[model samples]
Target: MPEREPLAPAVAATRLAVRRALAPYAGGAVVAGVSGGADSLALAAALAFEAPALGIAAVSVTVDHGLQAGSDAAARDAAEACRAMGLEARIARVEVAGPGGPEAAARRARLDALRAAAAQVGARAVLLAHTLDDQAETVLLGLARGSGATSLAGMSPARRDPDGLTWLRPLLGLRRGDTVAACAAQHLAPWQDPHNADEAFARVRVRRSVLPLLEAELGPGVAEALARTADQLREDDEAFRDMIDETIEDIVEHAEAGIAVSVAALAANPAALRHRVIRHVVASEFGVSLTRTQTLEVGRLVTDWAGQGPIDLPGCRATRSGGMVVFAARA
Candidate 1:
């Protein structure tokens, strides 16, 4: 790929990833999540130095997960790095909790902090430093779980944040080593989080255990190939979602508590789109999401359970009433 001006290849690649992810906000300011790691620091430095003329303003945000003893100091260090780059920076601390487990809890808190910071700066987009390796790990983990496309596809480059702001990944296509090289070139100090090397985490196990094995057995480009696969799946999923949106627009019936779908209209769609459309309806109407098993059960209902009673979902039920499939919560 061609280099973005005034930045080295690694930095240029980082910027390209972020810019492409945030293409919807072509001329807007961006809030970057800088975790003081090589990847994030390089991204912060590159965006600060390379994006002004491109009509992109940058803000650096450091989230202190508060998991380790010195996480606060690390956040401060990240903030200092941003200041050194001549960009405004903020240090946000989040107290990660349970019920979702530690990993997911930490992620939720970190995103919450980033979103808050983005809002404070009036930024409409938040940029993250997830690399190609992270994408591969995600895909592998998803594959291990045996879920369908949504899981296997891994993360999207850009998506809606919790606060409804756009979240962009500008380093998803670059390797971790490239970010390290960029840090070296820029003389920036990057923090090495010990949790990354800790084998206790599932992601670490995937990164340290699964990925290396795949590289040795399959090929050197295994990680890249996995990430590429995710990108392809993401594209396919998006197109499928667009088709679902169109179908919903044409055949939806909004009720007091939830929505109903015309059984005939749903049956007309292909099985793939049919399943997706049913899941969308369940999610939109009752704020309930279907699991893989639950989704298949719902799919079976389309043919076998034509005139049956209500089927249970996460937060609601799907019932065949008259000529439509109604999704509703029990009153």
Candidate 2:
């Protein structure tokens, strides 16, 4: 009998990555979010291959945003591909309607659909196919927005959202070309979304123009560098969050209308930690994200307090009273 060839390198690499990502969720059901794109198709294929060995029942979910023509058919085809891999599959048709633009609205709707699908299937985690290139683009977007460390940290490998659904991005360390090669090796024809090549979208422009420009201008490894920067920033942000949580427990008090933090404590900490604590408190209490200017203005009530009356903030107001900086609900 003729000997069977070993699995292709790209396929082996993808399966190894998926296996490592699913290790923690052993024996639990997992859902792969497939968009019929090369990245997601590779992810779905790898999950289908690795889940059985990990004792996980894998399911593929395709979300149809209905933005473009034939979207539903594309979603159905993705589901069919998953089924062909011997995994359960589902299609989630979501209505993309919200305040944000089409891209943002579509993303929000797709996430909601994925979470709902995961819950329905009793899956403990949903695997997403956001590759290293995606992370680099995210960092670039954050830089363009002049965001802080948390925003520049990009996406985490695994995160449990407020709704308690665990989201996993197993391909964050893999390159986009790796996924494309994996799909080719598996003989899986991926659907190319028109939006991906549309220059009107900021992400598409970044993917098509800016990234290539950077790679050309500065040689290579720009994406890897950006991804590394995100990884490092994420580690720092996690540590800072831990410190903030501990400090808040000791120094924060429940106010009549909102929350109060000790002015002395705020002033004593380093500037970075102090600012983060202030922002975290406001976000956690009032569900408002303070801009850098707003956060600094509030920080002034602690470090640079004089006889200032009250600083109006989004959804709340900050006032310096005695030894505490009180954030109260705006009347």
For all candidates in order, the CA lDDT equals 0.83, 0.93
Among these predicted structures, which one has the highest lDDT? 2
lDDT accuracy of residue 31 in candidate 1: 91
Per-residue accuracy of model 2 over 160-238 as CA lDDT, tens digit each: 9776778999999999999999999999999999999899999999999999999999999999999999999999999
Candidate 1 residue-wise lDDT, 1-331, digit = tens: 9875575777667666655665666577789999999989988877776667567777898988889999999999999989889788888888899666999998989888988887877889888888899999999988988877988889887788455798877788789999998898788989999998999989999988999998999889999999999989999998998888666888878865788888788778788888888888887766666877887777766666746678888888778777778777767
| Residue pairs that clash (backbone atoms under 3 angstroms), model 2 | none
Error of 1 at 257 (Å): 3.7
Quick one: how many clashes does candidate 2 have?
A: 0
Evaluated against the true structure, the overall lDDT of model 1 is 0.83
lDDT of 2: 0.93
In model 2, which regions exceed 4 Å deviation? Answer: 162-164
